[model samples]
Target: MAHIHLGEGSFPLWALVLWTLLGVGLISAVVYRVRKGGIKTHQIALAGIGAAASFAIFQLNIPVWGGIHMNLTGLVGILAGPLLGALIALVVNIFSAALGHGAVGLLGANTLVNASEAIVAYYAFKTLMGMDWDVFPASASAATLGLSAGAFLMGAIIVISGVNGSALPRGDLTVAVAGLVGLNLGVAVIEGLLTGFIVQFLASVRPDLVGLTDRDTREETTGVTA
Candidate 1:
């Protein structure tokens, strides 16, 4: 209900083809990585956990103007890393589709959009850490950036599909884009604060789950050891 649920006719053939290729490539890469990493039992369990969490949370519709839901994309990326995060997104989308949440025709497109969010969040968090920012600010900014990107992509998909069918009114694309941006920006702010606080708590209580160390903290620890 939250995601764009454009049915079979919404996307052009070229767009569908492109999205399918992209999804396949990404999935292949993740599978290769997991294979190379030796596929530990714990790793599989962790990935299952992330996928289940994403699937469950994705179903909780909030009934905003655009029917937005709590995505938790960035949080999963922070915990699972980019590859597993992307996999989780696809799994969630597929499962959601089964329950009449998102459209089966848009599966590839939806997977690309959500997977990109996870990748962005993971890399942005690492970049912020490399710049010596603390965990909370880094995570919050990453979540905001990731969600903003997802929002933009979602708007684009809606506009393109709508335009293809002349379903939108004259110049309504601007209004749609603006509305999505504004709505997502508000959601991003809330998610940012939530991610920041949750990350802080995880860092203190279960750094193993966070799997991140502040550069400054690491350097200090190194110096102490030296």
Candidate 2:
């Protein structure tokens, strides 16, 4: 949802290099962590499924807010965990760029934007669950917050990088970006509700799939003991 649809050279050369390096650094760290910790077979399968779903949704641009699309990165994060979710973001963006839906050069910036949503959503979901919030509300709130974070970050990046060949002043550009971010927040709500329903359904049918089995079991045992 936070994709920058600008062309290859839309960003200044220096900004391009800087964002690319930062994106690379983030991926490198994730890779190292993955290697050190090792992912489960199920997680790898989830990652594959997430990447496919994310890529499919990425192409179906809604005709609102300058044709924004839902990333579903929040849902991905919740199901697949943050590391795999971030990787899914990268993969989806790369495939989208290949199809000319997004700028190839802006992969780094876009990946950071989407990956942040996944990472934030994953932690937020865990935090809410830790507080004993129900699945529907927790997932909905986490997804909304995650998408909102990405929207603001997208605005910040655009403002900081300064669009090439644009006549808009810095102040005006910031304001414009803010408007776009605001629109994205509106879209986030709709997507969040949908995610909530899906997560709730999954939790009901397969708690283990959503990492809820242990919590549910513990609660059941406590009730029995009491």
Candidate 3:
């Protein structure tokens, strides 16, 4: 079975390097694509929607599913790539923390958690798009899976940080675990619905986004992946 969390010793410099590379590279490519395309109106609008969603999630602090917080920033990650999603979450977290939403020192960790969600969502969404399955259902399902996995991973990382046993009252590890899993499951359903709607809308209105690859059926989801 996969380890629930990477141990302290497990957080080697190499791992951080790889993760940073993956995280930064993912975002850079998406930015490059948008810039290369000459900044279409829809892309800008999408950026705005993504930005607003990130801010809303960051500000709202309703504790649910046994102390697990629900944030649509996971959905933001699904809609946008890691870089922009992480950047958006960072901005939101910074402002929210300033306004007293979360711990100030925790901003870096928060960005890491939320950004990981976006990275997973971006790749999983793209990979599903590359497959032979029906576009809408496949991508939607993959998006949910990606977000859920990220939530789970993020929860584990917090535990590894020993915040579970910290004097700070974030809640016990068991309670925190339950909340994380619960939030992920709930968020999955929401993102799945949203993804289905958005992808269908894009398909109908902007078919160019899903261009054909060499094969009649096969298509590249992200040009940067290759």
The TM-score leader among the candidates is 2
Q: Can you tell me which runs of candidate 3 are displaced by over 4 Å? A: 1-45, 65-70, 164-176, 209-226
Please state the error at residue 61 of candidate 1 in Å. 1.0
lDDT of each model, Cα atoms only?
0.76, 0.90, 0.56
- Per-residue C-alpha lDDT of model 2 across residues 14-98, encoded as one tens digit per residue: 9999888989998898999999999988888888988898889889887765568897998999889999988898999998999
**What residue pairs are clashing in model 2?**
none
- Top lDDT prediction, candidate number: 2
Superposed Cα deviation of residue 70, candidate 1 (Å): 1.1
Error of 1 at 163 (Å): 4.9
Show model 1 residue runs off by greater than 4 Å: 38-43, 161-164, 213-217, 224-226
Query: What is the lDDT for 169 in model 2?
Result: 100
Better of 2 and 3 by TM-score: 2
Query: Which one wins by TM-score: 1 or 3?
Result: 1
lDDT of 2 at 89: 89
lDDT ranking, best first: 2, 1, 3
